[model samples]
Target: MALASALAIGLLISAPGTSHGAGPRDVAGTRHAAGTHHLASEPGSPRTVSTGWSVPWGLSWLPDGSALLTERDAFKVYTLTRDGTKRQVGEVPNVVTTSGEGGLLSIAVSPSWNADHYVYVMHTAAEGNRIARMTFDGSALADYKVVVDGIRKNTYHNGGRIKFGPDGYLYATTGDARTPDLAQDRTSLNGKILRMTPEGKPAPGNPFHSLVYSYGHRNPQGITWDAQGRLWEGELGDQTYDELNLIEPGKNYGWPRCEGSCSTSGMTDPKRQWPVAEASPSAVAYADGAIYMAALRGERLWRIPVDGASAGTPKAYYAHTYGRLRTVESVPGTKSLWLTTTNADNSGEGEPGSDTVFQIDLT
Candidate 1:
């Protein structure tokens, strides 16, 4: 429950903003469904689900409309109530937890969470960051299988996020693990967004034969799609600029060799860029002809409009106010965007359980 502060004050709320009104206003802000955004579900003013979880990450709308959340530091994925009661659904195996960044990271519901009941996850496994599919039978996971395993591992840049594209193929984002050279290496999975079949094989018709859809990324944590089916990603820069890249098949993003908009031969340029201090974006989702980014270091939520592959100026909201927003998700099939907080991370602000899941009222 954050009060509506002036845009400037919102940016500074990262410092435990003094309560101008009462304690945490229970306002849903304004309606975000209209204006060129896609609407997933038209229900109410916007709801905040789950109260106690710290460092909430991945998010997606269920077929039934109940959203799913991932907590990077909690070790388990809980089925959160729209009104904020978290119920543990399952635990991720081989989750190597530390500090700064780590743990049960991202989860993607199967194209058929209702029937197939499978939910895919990307986490730091024993070998490295891997993707797994688990079947949740309402209260718990009935089966867990490591569909893809043994990716390169580095501490700082694990790049653990997974999403299923509209083409029914799986797309994953990997980090450079602080190793600049790996980003340019086609053979390596780090610092790249991979496209694979549901069975984990390289997607047919992909630029490369081995699931390397796009490469040369630093640390892409967020992955989304546009109405035209163009794949988009949010890349975290080490010390320079965070990027919003239009992920194309087999294209290179020029990691260590280039940062923002570079015209290196055969290398791809980011559609948008922000200094690391202003937007350490983790996840991104599209709506209203725009892509909203969840900032971890900047402690803000950034929005950028996309026209085909190009992007416009950033529209920032909940600036220091939400502390640290880790993931912004456009609830599937709708215009509602779920904005979750990461204020509980080691480098974040607020108490351990101050994070909340918010839904944007589209209509």
Candidate 2:
């Protein structure tokens, strides 16, 4: 067993059914039936939508039901039709695919895409990680413009996940980039959740009076908003724990000082934490009153039931059946979800043409 798994065994035996005082709750505001244990049976099976991708990473749906997908090591973006036909949009300009984890990471369609034809992307460049905008003219991509730059980047821990929130502001997740101190530095954009405008300016009413909306994160990847407009994040821990955090403006999620939960002043505790072997969670999506988290190392999809500000014990699906799940995107106007796998990447099992996109119907 891993160190985290051993630690969790001792902790569970000592505490029995509690989790650092705050545990997931059910719809009736009652304690979860499964208590603090994160293990649960698979809910349902997911249907394959597309396959044969090389490290597919990001996924975003367009207004016309077509979806945009990104390949991390390939540094390429493609549009996928409902029938699974893919057309290469273009390669992001100047993307550097490192041997480690940094590369073309995420894509976010502009809120005004119909009029502006703008699509934003986050990728690793020669200097560092950056967010850029390009015009997608239905068939091709052009008019490349750098929006945000100077975010630190290392071989790993780039934390490259970006999305447009319901509030019409762009939210991006950044990692410590191997520099842990940068997480605590308000002046640095590393290890922060940034809220910005469509024009790349800091969103008004940002908690830090800068681009940072939340700080002190290790390597947060998945970010999504609840029905109540509250932001939640999925974070990877360093050999100790994996966290699901309820993000709040200006809140400091304890990083180097604390891995899971701490008594430190001004540090926010995670709503749920699991052993790293069970959850190296990636992109998350909220649908049907639950948060769906895609796991990479753990090789599963976690379903955490949500009720207002509380979350319920998480259930696992497709554990080890499919390898290295990357991102989970909720389909608009339906109870279905889109998930992508990263088996073709270096860290994964690297099955031949094994990278695939799947559709899961929640109803």
Model 2, span 1-363: residue lDDT tens? 011211111000011121121223222222224334332222334566787888889988787988999999888899997678998989888899768889999999998889989999999999999999999988898988998999999998899999999899999999999999899998999999999998889999999789999999999999987766789999998988888889989999988787887789988888878788878999988776677888899887777876666777676766676778888887776556788888888874886466888776553
> Which ranges of candidate 2 are over 4 A from the true structure?
1-43
lDDT for each residue of candidate 1 in 1-363, tens digit (9 for 90 to 100): 111121100010122222221211111211122223232222124345446668877765567656567778776787764445667777777777746576788888888677788888888866788888888777787577888875777768888889899898989998887888998888888888888877788889988788788899888889987767788898898777788888878788999888876667987777777878878889887665667678888876676666656665565656566577787776544445677787787774667788777765443
**Model 1 TM-score (2 dp):** 0.85
- Kindly report which residue stretches of model 1 are placed more than 4 angstroms away from their true locations once superposed: 1-47, 332-334
Evaluate residue 314 in candidate 2 and report its C-alpha lDDT on the 0 to 100 scale.
73
**Highest TM-score: which candidate?**
2
* TM-score per model over all chains: 0.85, 0.88
Global CA lDDT computed for model 2: 0.80
Estimate every model's Cα lDDT from 0 to 1.
Answer: 0.71, 0.80
